[model samples]
Target: MSKKQWPSWGHGEQAQQHYLVEPRALAGGGDVRHVHAFLRACGWRDKTQRGGPLALQSPDRTVRIEYQPAGMPGGWTIQGAAAPGRDAWWAHLGAQTPVEIVAGFTDALTQPRAAHAPNVWAPLREQRWRRPPETEHVTATSPDGSAWVQYRPSAGGGAMWWSGAQDRQGNGWVAQFTPSTPLHLVEAFTAALASPEPVMRPLGHVPHSARLRTTSVSVLPSQLGAWQQARITAARAATWASTAPRNARPRSTAARHHAPTGGARARH
Candidate 1:
């Protein structure tokens, strides 16, 4: 069988932008849901899975897209939607980089010429549905700077948190983050590591690494931003104090590793 090729994110190193219009809007009234459904019907899945704006990725793992709703008054900003191509278009409507994708209207730059109006949706429809590859690593530092967590992308389309800390019993703890963990969730987990509580609380669905003694916690992406004030509280209370002494606190990568019970090997 022939390999399938999808559109690239355009010529620039940065993601070029484009707008999506409602299919039937030019005629009169229109709705954006049809466009959303068409994309879903074409095999896109909501990466977040939460009820919010759409965050979609191509099955071939070539594109990551964020789309706006029809009601938002101002033009929308899609942070992660870029792909290689001079232009991406819908048969009835189209758009290009920096183009505005309104709910019911396609911009002039992307509209296809009448001669090239053959089955526009065919390419996407025929695309083999597949999950995006794990290609990113995200990390965030704690407020006190004593500890940090590294969030590695998972091949299963979510994210895992690999953290370093020490238990009350002084055993080094190397735990994994829950699936699809968000920033705040990881932050909360880190904060818990600093808590004065004797037993270090688990964060997310951490799993034990047979090679490196560890445990897991279940975390919810829904609770992402909920830890802002709580994190501040923990920081004020010096939650990470149990890990190291005042002057001997972990101030760098080597120190964080030292703070843990033993050297932990990272899993792929």
Candidate 2:
């Protein structure tokens, strides 16, 4: 995708920037490496064996992330331990879920934020999702009503708190977030779902079921190469900064100038 094809941001003058009427769906299984990079940046430890699925644990052991290629239930699983006045939570991304969409959850997880309850339905609402009066559920459906998101509040005992399905024929993918999951995380996920930014996928990689909802565009191979390189560079920089010593300081110019003099001052 070219720079001009990228989505615009903000409102008014900024909104005037040319934006695609429909989002482009890119090809490829969601990249797990990006998730790993974000976790590493936030002090999470990798515990994957040579041939095992990817696994990571938080510095405090309060959160866990795992990615299974087989994806019997879900390919990506993230869990948080119970905290003060808050219950334990789990989120799952199906194997077919897009990396850009999955990144929304991980990105929000790594960000620093004040403690407050976020309105999980706000993003969906802004996108014209319907909430029946006095009901606990909010729903958003695709134009053809094939794909939809159903959000149920205060669900209990193995009930799905958030459920998303991509096709009516049961051939597409599904994702779920369990009860007590962080609202902000769900908000981020919904925001990403409602975002106008196109997801770049190769023509061959785009799913047959989702083609109707996506716009076909000629994305250069170099664009994917550059995108991957930029992500690698950012992840490396973040890792370096995170691991740097807090107490370390650079030598002053005076110290550099006096290095050859040892403890004695040179006579002028």
Top TM-score model? 2
Residue range with the least summed lDDT across 10 consecutive positions in model 1: 18-27
lDDT per residue as tens, model 2, 121-215:
67766767555455456666644444456765553566565545454334455678876787788888877765545554444565555433444
Q: After superposition on all CA atoms, how large is the RMSD of candidate 2?
A: 13.3
CA displacement after TM-score superposition, residue 175 of candidate 2 (Å) = 2.1
Off by over 4 Å in 2: 1-28, 41-43, 114-116, 132-136, 142-144, 153-159, 210-222, 232-268
Which TM-score value belongs to model 1?
0.20
C-alpha lDDT of candidate 2 relative to the true structure: 0.59
